[model samples]
Every structure is written in structure tokens, then in C-alpha cells.
Target: MQQSLSRGSSPLALLMRGVSRLNLYLAGFSAFVLLAATAAVFCEILSRLFFGKSLVWVVELSGYSLLYMTFLGAPYLLEKNRHVAIDIVTEHLPPRLQMPLAFLVALFGAAICLYAAWYGLAVTLDQFQYGSRETTVLAPRSYLLTWVFPLGMVLLSIQFVAQAVACLKR
Candidate 1:
């Protein structure tokens, strides 16, 4: 009975816990990025209105911050089952079929995320190897910003695997 009760407490649960923590951190960081972007935009607006000038980096940085925030928060959103989904059909399905369907969906999502992560890493590496830089006032290395894509996708893929396993265990 104890073993059966503990069946759900597998190594996957441990991995999920770690991944959950990481996602939480990423989500918090994303929130900070969002706040910073808001501040930058506000500052730029004020500067332009009052001083007839604006920081060139503000617009570029705000765009990058928005991108970073979306990517970083995505894994956490997936883990929390907060992403947008049209589940009218699934919700009406019988309980017997629901788990399997959910598992399959998660598996498909994981596969897509894994592919994206691979592609993003390849692109970032190519940029880094070729010494690519953004054509902006800040002019940061493009690869440095691009690295967030693979990192976020990897996290999202892990969360999807966790979701699939949870569905199976159901």
C-alpha cells in the first residue's frame, strides 16, 4: 500500500521539482525585465517630451526586454497550465480518454519545443562564431541576446515532458 501510494513520487517528480524552481526564477527575472522595460519607455517618453531628445538605446532595449520576458515566462506559464488553449472539445471528452489525449498533446508540444531549442542553439552558435553584432547604438553581440531563445525553449521542453509524465501518472 505504501509503495503504491508512493508510486507517483518517482525520480521524475524530483526532476520536476527542480525544473519548477528554475521556472519560478525565470518567471521572476522576466517580471523584472518587464518592469525595467516599462521604466525605460517611461523615461524615454519623458525625455522626448521635455528635453526634445530620447535615448537611442531605450527603444532597442525595450524590444529586447519584451522578447526576453516572453521567452523566460513561457516555461513557467506552461508548468502552471496558464498558456492560452481552446479546450472546449477536450473538456467534454470522457475521463477515460482525457488522460491519453492530454499526454499525447504534451508529447507533441515537447517535441516542437525540443526542435525549436535545437534550431535556436544552432543559430546562436553560428552568429557567435561569425561575430555578429546588432546594428544599434548599444551594438551588443547578437548571439548574447539570441542565447535566451534556446534557454527558454529548453526549459519549456522540460516542462512539457513533466506535464506528459503527470498525465500518464493520472
Candidate 2:
């Protein structure tokens, strides 16, 4: 029997290394956003409790932080397969079918993410076309930042495909 043993990627190692660096950068950015969100929440809580003044923008910033963190971390999370899953059925499945089933689930999840990303991109574009802005103070360009959703989802989709390929090879 000829066994095809998967080995190191000498040809694409450079590309993989670059991608790893990018993922690290994204993870760092997400961590920074999370820290900023925590600080904003803390300051908002303190201000509201002690001075009877609220940081209205804090709420919006917190929302942005949440979105950034979620989107930025998605690719890395998928690469690691760290998302929570109900493994009872998968675990009981025979060894031969496990990879296929997992790949199907991942493909389904990728499709859903892709659809959400498409809508997000469309909405963001519409906002850009209309020059949409928040009603509150600071009035940041809401639509420009909205493109992050589609960009992140695209990265996640690629990660899902790579993961599926890895599983099939195993």
C-alpha cells in the first residue's frame, strides 16, 4: 500500500507565514479593542454612578468594539476550530464519516457567514452612498467601518475551506 503522508509546505510556507503574521496582527488588534471596551465601560460606569453624567458615546464605541473583536477573531478561531460545537453526534459517528460530516458543518457555517457578509457589504455600501453617520455626538462614519464585516467573513470563509481540506487529508 502506498501511503500519501502529508508533510510540511515548503512551497507555501512563506505565504502561510505571512498569513500567520496577519492573523497575529488581527488578534492583537482585537485584544486592544477589547481592552478599550473594558476601559470605556469602566469609565462610563464610574461617571454615571459618581458624577451623574453619562458617556453617551461610550455605548456606541462599545458596540463598535464588540463588532471589531468578533470579526477580527473569527478567522483565527476557525483555524483553531475553537468554536463551541455539540460533538455528541460527531463523536458517535464512525471514523470514516467524521471528517466529511465536520466538513459539511463547516461549509454550512461558511455559507451562512458569507450570506451575512454580503448583506453587510451591501448595507455598508448603501450607507456610504448616502453618507450615513451616527445621530449622536462624534458622528463617526458608520458605513466606512461596516465593510469590516464582509472582509472578516471572507477571511473566515477561506479559513473554513483550509480547515476542511486539512480534515479531509487526515
Candidate 3:
């Protein structure tokens, strides 16, 4: 929380702190979504095998859950240093040079995510305007799922900015 005040008296700092905390909660929700998807798969298998029945929505919902899980959990993974990386050059550099490199990488990542978020929001808005729906089992509104992409991207961008700031401080 280097970006945040010690007493957290500032409104922007407080809001960002709250958002960071919320990101963790969202990651937990993402995990729950995965667990639920697993249970759903099991349920579908059991129903089909034992009762000769099928849950038509199981596969579709599971696919949607996968998308949600990935986006929602990404920030948590990055924050924890668990995100995938190919640091062939960075690992060879001295500690002094590494922080700046990390800072640059984080800024680049933040920029990309922000760009994607902008396009995602636009796509979602277009879907909403068209009242689009998936042609799959549930035929759910397209915007319902599309909204998550922009939201997740924005959260991820913020996380990247925070990481960049921390790296700069080092």
C-alpha cells in the first residue's frame, strides 16, 4: 500500500485500497466459480450415467464460468507473483537494473490492459444496443458476459499500475 497513505485519510487512496481488497474477494469468487463448475460437471455426468438424463445448461454455464474465473483470478495471480513469465534476460540482470525493467514491463502491461478494456467496453455496449443473445443452450444476453471482460481488464490494469508504482519505489 505504498500508494496509499499511512492513515488512509485521502479519498482516492482509500478508494484504491478498498478496490485492492475487493480484487482479492473477486479472486475468491472466481475460485468458487471453478468449484461450482466442477460440481456441475460431476452432476451432469452422474445424471447422464445413472438417470439417463442431461442438464442442458451445464456445459454452457461451465464455459461461461471458465471465462469469469480466468479474468477474475488474473490480478490475484499477478499480485502474488504467480503469473506466468519468461524472464530469460531479467533473471540475468543485477537487482538494481531489475526493478526498472519490472517497472517498464508493468507499465506496458497496464497500457495493454487499458487498451483492451476500452475496446471490451465498446463491444459490450454494442452488444447491449443490439440486444444480442448467445445462440447456445441458455441464450443469455451477450452483454451480461461481455461486461465481465471490460470490468476484469480494468481491475487488472489498476493492479498493474500498482505493481509499477511498487517497482518504482524499490
> Global lDDT of each model?
0.86, 0.76, 0.86
Candidate 3 — worst ten consecutive residues by lDDT sum?
Answer: 1-10
Tell me the tens digit of each residue's lDDT in model 2 across 1-170.
00121235564555555555676688789999999999999999999999999998898888888889988877766665676668999899999899899889778777887888888899999999999997767788878568778878877776665566666768
Candidate 2 residue spans exceeding 4 A from truth:
1-13
Candidate 3 yields a Cα-based lDDT of: 0.86
TM-score of each: 0.89, 0.83, 0.90
Candidates ranked by lDDT: 3, 1, 2
Off by over 4 Å in 1: 1-11
Give Cα distance to truth, residue 169, candidate 2, Å.
1.1
Best-first order by TM-score: 3, 1, 2
